[model samples]
Target: MKIVIQRCSRASVTVEGQVTGEIGTGLMVLVGVTQEDTEKDAKFLADKVAGLRIFEDEDGKMNRSVLEIGGKVLSISQFTLYGDARKGRRPSFIAAARPEQAIGLYEAFNEAVKAHGLEVQTGVFGADMQVELVNSGPVTILLDSRE
Candidate 1:
């Protein structure tokens, strides 16, 4: 499991010119699942993301978690995080999980995030989506279950 977490003041996803999921003041999470990913990996990431202290506190120090700031989450399925292009002009997606297996884990990850008592929005799985966001501080974090 791998995730790219971007802190944002607002974010939204659109499919076929229709808005699917939208949020104000939150994290835009791009998630990727590999063949080895399981519910345990999902759970670990959910906990880590929810408690991550990326938001700034009153003193301008990054000391607050999203929950503390009453922020939301916009989760998107992004298998391309596993793309490998080191050896060729074209990238290989062999590390990405098959759609059937990935969908389940993706849903599980969202559920795990919701278990933290924070609002969670999502993009349509397997759909072509256009995501927009105002990145707050441009703060971004990368997480990998294997690490």
Candidate 2:
């Protein structure tokens, strides 16, 4: 599992010109799953994202976790994160997990995040979606379960 976590002032996802998920002062997460990903991986990344301290403190230090600052999460399934382009003009998506396998883990990840007492909004899996976000601090982090 690979997660691209972005601290955002606001974010939303649209499908077929209709807003599907939206948030304010939260994390905009792009979640990717590979063939080896499992339920454990989802749980691990969920815990990490919820606890990650990217937001600023009173002293302007990055000391506040999203959970502490009452932030929401806008999660979108993004299999293309695994795309490999080193060999050709077009990227290869062979490393991405099959939809049958990924959707389960993706839902598990959302559920685990919700269990941490934070609101978790999500875009429809396998849908053609558009995401918009105001990246606060432009702060971003990449998490990999295997690592």
Candidate 3:
């Protein structure tokens, strides 16, 4: 499992010109599942994302978690995170989980985040989506279960 977490002032996802998921003052999470990913990986990453102290406190220090700030989450399924472009010009997605398996884990991840008592919005799995966000502080973090 891999995730790219971007702190955003606001975020939304659109599919076929229809808005799907949207959030304000939260994290935009792009999740990727590999063949080896399991529910445990989903839970671990979700917990980390929820408790991450990237949000600034009153002193302007990055000491508050999203939960503390009453923030939301916009989770999106992104298999390209596993794209292996080390070889030729084309990228290979062999490391990414199949859609059937990925969708389950993706949903599980979102549920895990919601379990933290924070609002969680999501983009449709396997759908062509257009995501828009105002990245707050340009703060971004990358997480990998294997690491």
lDDT of model number 3: 0.97
The CA lDDT at 17 in model 1 is 97
Estimated TM-score for each candidate = 0.99, 0.99, 0.99
- List where candidate 2 sits over 4 angstroms from the true fold: none
Residue 62's lDDT in candidate 1: 99
lDDT by residue (tens digit), candidate 3, 15-34: 99999999999999999999
Against the true structure, what is every candidate's RMSD?
Answer: 0.5, 0.5, 0.5
- Evaluated at residue 75, the lDDT of candidate 2 is 96
C-alpha lDDT (0 to 100) for residue 36 of candidate 3: 99
Clashing pairs in 2: none
* Candidate 2 residue 1 C-alpha distance from true site, Å: 0.2
Task: Supply candidate 2's per-residue lDDT for 65.
Answer: 94
